[model samples]
Target: MRPDNEVLIVGAGFGGIGAAIEFASLGIDDVAIVEREDDLGGTWHVNHYPGLAVDIASVTYSYSFEPNPFWSRLFAPGPELKRYAEHVAEKYDLTRRMEFGTSVTGARWDDESGLWTVSTADGATRTCRYLVTATGFLSQPSTPDFPGMDTFTGTVLHTAAWDDSVDLTGRRVAVIGTGATAVQLIPEAAEVAAELTVFQRTPIWVVPKIDFPIPRAVQRLFARIPATQRAVRLVNTSLLEMLMVFGVLHFRQARLGNKAGALLARAHLRAQVSDADLRRRLTPHYDLGCKRPTFSNSYFRAYTRPNVTLETDGIGRIEPDAVVTGDGRRIEIDTLVLATGFDLWDTNFPAFEIVGRDQLSLGAWWRESRFQAYQGITMPRYPNLLSLNSPYSYSGLSYFTTIEGQMRHIGRLFGELRRRGASTFEVTGEANDAFLDEVTDHLADSVFYLGNCAGSHSYYFNHQGEAALLRPNATLTTLRAMDTFPLDDYRFH
Candidate 1:
C-alpha cells in the first residue's frame, strides 16, 4: 500500500473514532483509520465474554456530540456498545476511511521528509504527515504465565480475549482473579457451569450497580427533549464527582470517607448473600477506593449458588487440569479463565520500534522518565504525533469525555499549525518538563497519594507505585487546559 492520507489513526476505539470525527468536522478528509480487528469497536469487538458491560452509565459513557437516546440499559453491554460504535462510524462516514484487519507494528518519524513512516505486521508500509495512536489502555490482554498452562488438556481463555466456541454449559470451570472482568463473568458462568470455582487473590470492594433498562418512552422523551437528557447527565456527573471528592479529601474523617463506602458495600453484601461466611469472604480488607471499586448486584449473589465456590486461598500454580492452591489444596477443572487484566504501564514493545528525534525511542524515553505528554496528546520529541488516552489521561468520569478533550486539543493544534503555515509542530523540552512537574505536584495532593490507603499491584499504579492511569480531576479541567493550543509552548519547524 502507498501513502494515502495526511493523518493515520491506529486502533478504531472510542479515541480513534473521536479523532476521526473531529478531523472530519474540521474539513480534513485525508485521514485513515487502521484497525487490527476485522471490525470496528476495538476492545468491545474482542471482549465478548459473558456479562461484559460498561461500568459507567450509558448516557455519560457515549459521545456527548452524538447522543444515543435509545440505549437499552443504563450500563450497555458489549454487543450493544459495539453496534453503537459501528453506527457512529457509519453515520459519520468513517468506515470508508478505515482499513480493517490492518495492524500497525511500528511508526517512525522521518526528520527529512517531515512525515511518519508506518509499518504493518504484513510488511506493508505507509506514510502520513501526522500519526495518532489510540491503542486504548485495555487493548492488550495480560494472560498470566501459569506453569503447565500449555500442557493443559482443557480449554483455557482470558476474559478480555474470550473464545465464544467454548461452551460453559455443564462444564467444570475455574476462574482466576477477582478483578472487574472476573467479577462480572463469574456470575454468568456460575449459572451455566456444572461446577464453578473462583480463585481470588485479594478481595475487591463491591457496590450495587443500580442498573435498569431505559424504557422506550423515556428514550423518546430524551430524543424529543435533549436538554432533559443533558440535565440528567449533568446530575449524574455531579453526583459522581462529589463522591470522588468526598472519598479523596475526607478519607480519614471517620464514617465520612472510605468508611462510608465500606459500610455501604458491607450492607450490599449482606442484602445480596445469605451465607455469613460467604459475606465475610466478600468484604474487602483494604480501603474502598484504593483499587477500582467493582459495581455488581449479581457478583456476590452468584457465590450463594449451590454450584459456585469462592476460594480465598491464593493459587500456587497450575497443575494440568487443576489449580493448585498455596495451602496444598487443588481444584480440578475442565476449563480455566484468566481475568488477570492488562499491563497498562508496561510500555514494552519489542516487535515495534519508534525512533523519535536524535534516534530516541518512545520506550526508552518513558523508561528514563515516566511517560510525559503535553495535554496527554503531544510529546516533546515526537512532532506531529498525538496519543489519545495516554498516561495520566484516564478519569473516574467517562472515558468518552476525555477522548473528546484530547480530540479537541489535537484539532486546536492542527488549526494553529495550519494558520501559522508550520510544517512541523513539536512541544518544547522546557514546556514538557514544566507540564510534567505540574502534573506530578497535582498528583501529590490528589487521592492517589493523600488517601490513607496502601497500594497494591493494580493497572492504575505503575511499578513506581504512582497512579499513572487516571487524571486526578474532573473532565472540565482537562478540557479547559486543552481548549487552546499555546503555540509559544511548542517549537515550529
Candidate 2:
C-alpha cells in the first residue's frame, strides 16, 4: 500500500527540524512533524524555570548552517532559544507541516507493504514510508517517589514543568536533586524564596561560567559576514572538543587533563564558598567527567547565602508542611520542587513503542540484549527507520553537533537509496555489530571506564553498565564518517 507521506518525523525539536530541512533539500516535501507539546522548541519550551539557559556557548548550541546573529548573551536564555526554534521553522517552511499537541503511542512496520503505521494518542493512525524518531533523550521527566508525597499540602513543582503562576517570593521552598537543572535553578530560587533548602544526593562538578553579552557591532558583523560567526563557532567547538576528548574520553591517555579539570572545579568551589565544611559537602567525590559537569557563576555562591541551607543528609519522607531528613530532622517548607532528572534508559530510550521486522520491540530488544544502533541511527531489523536519538548517537557536548551530523548521515544514506532506486533500506546485522564494537572499544579508555565513578549517580551509564549515550569520538571524526560512511553498510531492495 502507498504511504500517507514520504517521511514522518516523531518530534518538532532541533533534531526533527534538522531532519526536515535536510529532507527538503533532497527534494522530499511530503513530510509531517508530530510534537507532543503544545508548540515546538521541545526542551526550551517545556523547561522555563527561573534560570533556564543553554549551558554550552550560544554560538555552538545552534545549527552552524543557521546561526542567530542576535543572541543576547554568550549562553542564550530559554526564551531566545525558543525564538530561534521558531525562526528556523518559519525560514524552512516547516511550521505548516507540524502537528502540535499530538502524542504518538506506538508504531508497527509491515514487511509485505513496506509501510509503517503509527498510532497516536487520539486513536488515529498515520502511515508513512520512512519513520524518524527524534523524541529526544530528555522527553520523560522523573519525579522521586518519596513517602507521603501525596499528602503534601504545599505547592509542588518539577523543574521540567515549573508553574510560573505560583509566586516563589517569601515562600519556604525545598529543592530535591542537584543535577544540571538544579545547579541553574537553586541560585535563582534562592534570590526570591524566603527560605531555601537544597537536598543533594550527589554533588555536581561546578566550573566557572565565562559569560558575557554579545556586542551589537559584533552581531551586525556576523549578520553581514556569516563567516565571522562560523569562525567563532569553530573556536568554541574546538575548546569543547578538548574537554570531551582529552579531559573525558581519553581519561587513561590524558589523565593530566582530567585531573586539571577536577582541580579547576575544586578551585572554583573554594573561591566561592568560604565555609570549609560547606565546601567539603559541595565537592564531588567521583571524577570530574563521571557525571555531566556544568558551568555556573552563582550556583556555588547560592549556598553561601544565609537563607539557603544545603542538606547533605538524605531525605527520609515528605510531610504535609515539611520534609523529614534521614537524621530525623524536620525542615518546614511551603513549596516542594523536584529537580530529579529524566528516565533515560527506560521510557526515554525509544520514547514510544516501536515494532520492527519479526515483531521485534525496539525497547524490549535494547533491554533484553543491548542498546545497539548502526552509527546511532539504524538497527538491524528496523527497515526504513531512522532513530535520530539512538544509543551512541550523541557526538559532542553541543547537541546541535549531533543533530547536524545526523542530518549529514540522513542525506548521504538517502542519496545512496535514490541512486539505487530503492524503497526499503536496512542496516546489515554485521554492520550494526561492527559499529557497536568500534564505539565500545573506543569508550574503554573513557572516564566512564577508567575514572572513579562509583559515587556518581550518572545516567550516562545505562542499566547494563554501558556508557552508550555518547559516541566516543571527536566531533569532526563523527561528521566525516557521516559524510563518507560505506553505502554497502545497508542492504537496499
**In TM-score terms, which candidate is top?**
2
How would you encode candidate 2's per-residue C-alpha lDDT over 186-223 as one tens digit per residue? 99999999999999999999999999999999999999
* Model 1 Cα lDDT, one tens digit per residue, 105-139: 88888888888999999998989988888888887
Question: Model 1 compared with the native: what TM-score?
Answer: 0.95
Candidate 2 lDDT score relative to the true structure: 0.95
Assess the local accuracy of residue 358 in candidate 1 as a C-alpha lDDT between 0 and 100.
82
Q: For each candidate in the order shown, give its overall lDDT on alpha carbons.
A: 0.81, 0.95
RMSD of candidates 1 onward, in order: 2.2, 0.7
Report how far residue 246 has shifted in candidate 1, in Å.
3.7
Scanning candidate 2 in windows of ten residues, the lowest lDDT window is 341-350
Top-lDDT structure, candidate number: 2
Give, for candidate 1, the lowest lDDT window spanning 10 residues.
248-257
